[model samples]
Target: MTLPAVPPISFQDIATELRLLPGEGLSFSWDNVKRLLGMSRLHPGPISLSDFLGKTRPWWGLVPVRSNDIVGTTWYSWNQSDGGLAAAVDPYFGNMPITAIMSTVSASGSDSIINFQSDPGFRNNIKAQLLDDNYNVVREVVLTYNAQAGVQWRSATLGGGDTSTCLFIATGIFTINLIKL
Candidate 1:
């Protein structure tokens, strides 16, 4: 036997069924209201400001741009196709020649072997470092580049079979003023 046809429901029908009158703002529980509105899949409650700002993907390296923050001073996380983890930051600090420090740790939460490399052409005066558990310097390298020709950028990578935390800290006078994570 065939089932009887069901009538299509609309906003007015839902509101009426819930006894919600005009100008009578949401007297029913939020869940009930959502259910009546066919929005049951939505989150049950309001999300925190940090979550709204993309902090939920910390492991994925999503950084939320904020007001009153210095330009190009943030390091963002990146994931490589070969199952490696990486982080990068813009090294351009405008014309004043200010020293900017950018750092990031391994996304895996454990010590892992890693390497640091700066963008090929714009690397003068860039000090890249790896720190240990006590924050002591493990390995450090200074990247040099032609001052007038290339843009400033730095990156760090976590490699295979390695079991040491990766912390990258770079201090230098960068050329550009734009933020590129």
Candidate 2:
């Protein structure tokens, strides 16, 4: 079946509405969490499958440091609980439609791991996926990342054609629910 097209929205825009703390504490307001998940009211924390079906928010997101720059590779890895991940993509295509599933993982004094998984077929030759809280595919991109051994910022590629352009965010034991609807 063909899906309707809806433009992508930024997490910051959603975060601003939800009043989420920025790089500080981990307290998320109940009401904002509901809105972030696109729920009418807040359900139990760590939303369940029932909640997932009712929501429309992206399943995953990556917090942009500056307007154009995404955070960092280390942050994108599942090792850092506080770190984040944007959907992987090919740079050749300016924009590709997607629905994503995402999660963050970090233990005390440990690296963060941001896991993202999705099919490239849905978006038509897309490279990677972005996720929402319920592990849903929210965004797709045509970009890839190349991380040197000790680099801070990752060099993003335009497409998934180059193996050297790809980087994997280590999948640590970050708890996330990614369900393709």
Candidate 3:
């Protein structure tokens, strides 16, 4: 959605407003008050999802989740408590639209086993990659929605027993209902 055009407010305008005396009274409107307090500056305006995701750093806003749904659920491997496979089993997460991208680097040279995670409930495209120390992609796989198997987590073992630090990245959109499974 397009945001309404708001006239740029200058520092001089703010200074004049601050300088107003009690007898003179304040001329600022509610919108002006919001602008002066930097509330309006917090939003960068509406942006397309594709463009938003493409950015190195994207701005996002949180919306209230369904009361029945679990809050703060994430799909990260390191999050052993409430994340990773645990989040996948939450009934509320089923059929929930999820767009996530994450990466991690192997800590040790002997780290041949890299654990990857994705929303098992995803119904769209998912991409997983293994990259070498030089940022060169060693193994890459893109999984599309499948009716038979569906999208599941995948793992890649580095060949040649080579164990230089490697980066693993996964990006996907998942929307599956656990009740159906």
Write candidate 3's Cα lDDT for 36-136 as tens digits: 23224333444222221111111111111111112422222222232332232222234233333222233222121112244444454434344333223
* Overall lDDT per candidate, in order of appearance: 0.31, 0.33, 0.30
Model 1, residue 162: distance off in Å is 22
Global Cα lDDT for candidate 1: 0.31
- In candidate 1 the C-alpha lDDT for residue 86 amounts to 28
TM-score of 3: 0.22
- Give candidate 2's root-mean-square deviation (CA, Å): 15.9
In order of listing, the candidates' clash counts read 5, 42, 5
Descending-lDDT candidate ranking: 2, 1, 3
Stretch of 10 with least lDDT, candidate 1: 53-62
Q: Which stretches of candidate 1 lie over 4 Å from their true place?
A: 1-83, 89-124, 147-181
* Candidate 2, residue 142: lDDT: 37
TM-score on alpha carbons, each prediction: 0.22, 0.20, 0.22
Q: For residues 1-181, what per-residue lDDT tens digits would candidate 1 score against the true structure?
A: 1111244434444444444568666423354453323233243544221222211111011122111213433332222222222223222322222222233333333221212333323233544444332223355544333334343333333444232322333232221111212
Q: For candidate 3, what is the total of clashing residue pairs?
A: 5
Expressed as tens digits, the lDDT of each residue in 1-181 for candidate 2 is 1111343434444444333468533333454455445443435566533332324333333432211113422223332223445343322222232222222222222111222233233322224444445434344333322133111212233223332322223333232222233
